[model samples]
Target: MARPRTPLLSPDRIRDAALTLIDAQGLAALSMRRLADTLGVQPSSLYSHYATKDEVLDAVANRVVREVDTSGFARGWRDGLLIWARSYHSVLVAHPNCAPVIASGTQRREQFLEMANSVHGGLVGAGWPARRATEISGAVKYLVIGAASTPFGSGFADDVQVYLDRYPHLSQAHRLRHEANRIDHDSFELGLTSLIRGLEPGPGQTE
Candidate 1:
């Protein structure tokens, strides 16, 4: 004989469960029924919290982003940009399955907007013009998303190597030395620093 099961389910709980499922099985595997079953709740119960699967996805993305520790950004603009970029990169890499959904549906969440505003404010306060700050932020974000989403498979790697082999000059200039090309979380900080340094005002320049 089997015993009955019960578990309390709220919006946050559902979202956490969904995140765990996505992390384990990829984003395509997530569905209301699956989440409900995991939580021991009826499928209809999810609708009481999230109107649609997209809503649940939005919540998941927000949850991932919220895991980033933005407190260290209080130092200054340079430190702020480094922290923001690395934080985003870390969070996205942690949930590779959610990256595509995040790239697509990020705008649907208010927390996304709030994070953007906070970055913008920090950049603006650091002496960057509003337009430049916004542009740079957007560029850095797209770069991170683009890099993270790059497919890693035997076929893709072989194709890339073959293409590079054909271009002698390009191949020489862009060597794929494993040690040199390897970039962990700290590597992103170097890129952020370089970009910010290039954007910084020269000596005697006004804000």
Candidate 2:
């Protein structure tokens, strides 16, 4: 061939390969040697692009956030929050295994900052005071991430009937799952709505 379209060990390509490995094998299985072997390149070549595994993991973590559409915030703060929450949920659900990477907070600096700025700006523009905006954004981040990482089962499935009998409240909730095989979007939306609604200003509150 005359010339390759791109470098054999570019950062983007490296992150993509690493992500695929992570998605299939879990984070513990990753290593420079393993990635290089998978990429058909020398392990040293990987160092030229990423000096350590953490850098690669950061890229993979940020990749999930990079997929979210922050532009939804432009519509208005409440709608913006809802849209961003939905986008975040979609990405994490698709790559549940990668949740810890993002949860660890070792994201690529630039992308994370850009995302934070957009959320803060959107809220301020929509009439939230600065401090409150920061707090609300933080709460929303945790809620969305928590929802994403929540296990599908209540951990009572092994003896669900017995457990349900003891916990009347849980029994009421368990009845709803009979109609579904997995966590449904309606449940998430209900929580999301209640959360955003709670953030609404109360009497005597003025920004």
Candidate 3:
């Protein structure tokens, strides 16, 4: 039999296996041993590819980031930011398990940082100061990750009665705009656009 161009002992395979495990059950379910078992190899053998589980997870984190469509880069910076934000939200919704792991610094990998840097660099090059660019980039990143990390039922009053009776304002708001209260995908983009609009620099604004 011919060997596949990509060999079995490859970063891709290891990272995929780890990601599958994490995405399926949760990150805690994926130990080195579990990953090795899934790969049909011994745990010690995996050490050659990933010295520790964290290394494997870091690779997986980057793999998830790879799914993001940065093609918005060619469309101009604002479009780029929206595209990146939407891509991020899509990826996280597909793999909710990875959001917290990515956000929590359990494996502080460089791919995400590099992505952030690209946004910040574009903004700065477009006349925003480095400090303001960083803020905008950070805020955009937070908007996606923070929204993704929030559990579905979270932020709402756990006690339904409290949400309805005591919090009349909250109840009315929910009743008035049920769609907005739903945490739907459009909500994220709406918030992202608003953030961009708020931070849009004035005529030739800079530090």
Candidate 4:
């Protein structure tokens, strides 16, 4: 058999496989050995493409960050930020397993840093002071991360009695999980809109 001209491993392939493993089995399930098994390659092969598991996870984070749409800034800070928040939330929701890595807030990954830079720049360019711009960026990040941290409605017990007996205020809480999808989405939108509005500049507000 002629040796295949191309190596079986590549960065893209490694990143994609890593993400798939994380998405299904979660971050803890990712190991060089398991990844090799998943890829049907020797463990050493992964080392050639990635120095360590952390590097592979970083690649996955980059992939996620790259999907966020920062172009909304062209419209203006408010609109751009709302779009950015929604986009970030949507991406995190789709890859809930990756939330920890994405929300770590300590990444120096290229795409993540670029996303941060775009937000800060947009705010500053729109007249927010540098200090306030940083705060806004971080605040918005926290909001999105919190919203995507878990399924809000699903957190409640499904049994109506669970709330009714001890928590009269939560009589309808049991139904929340049944409508987790819509409730979580609508709740995120409500929070996002309110947060953005609150962050909006006021009359005579200046640095």
Please name the candidate that would achieve the greatest TM-score relative to the true structure. 4
Show where candidate 2 strays beyond 4 Å.
1-7, 153-181, 202-207
For residues 111-163, write the lDDT of model 1, one tens digit per residue.
78878888888777767778987887897787667656752311233334665
lDDT of 4 by residue, 87-160 (tens): 99999988988988887736589998999999998888777888988998888888889877777653565456
Model with the higher TM-score, candidate 1 or 2 = 2
lDDT of each: 0.73, 0.77, 0.75, 0.83
TM-score, every prediction:
0.76, 0.80, 0.77, 0.87
lDDT of 1 at 15: 91
Candidate 3 lDDT trough over 10 residues, lowest sum: 173-182
- Give the per-residue lDDT of model 3 (tens digit) for 102-207: 7876424677777776777777666777887777778898898888887443355544565687667777655533354265566677899898788644318432
Error of model 4, residue 201, in angstroms: 3.2
Q: For model 4, give the 10-residue run with minimal summed lDDT.
A: 198-207
Q: Pick the candidate with the highest lDDT.
A: 4
The regions of model 1 sitting more than 4 angstroms off are: 1-7, 151-193, 200-207
For candidate 1, the 10 contiguous residues with the lowest summed lDDT are: 151-160
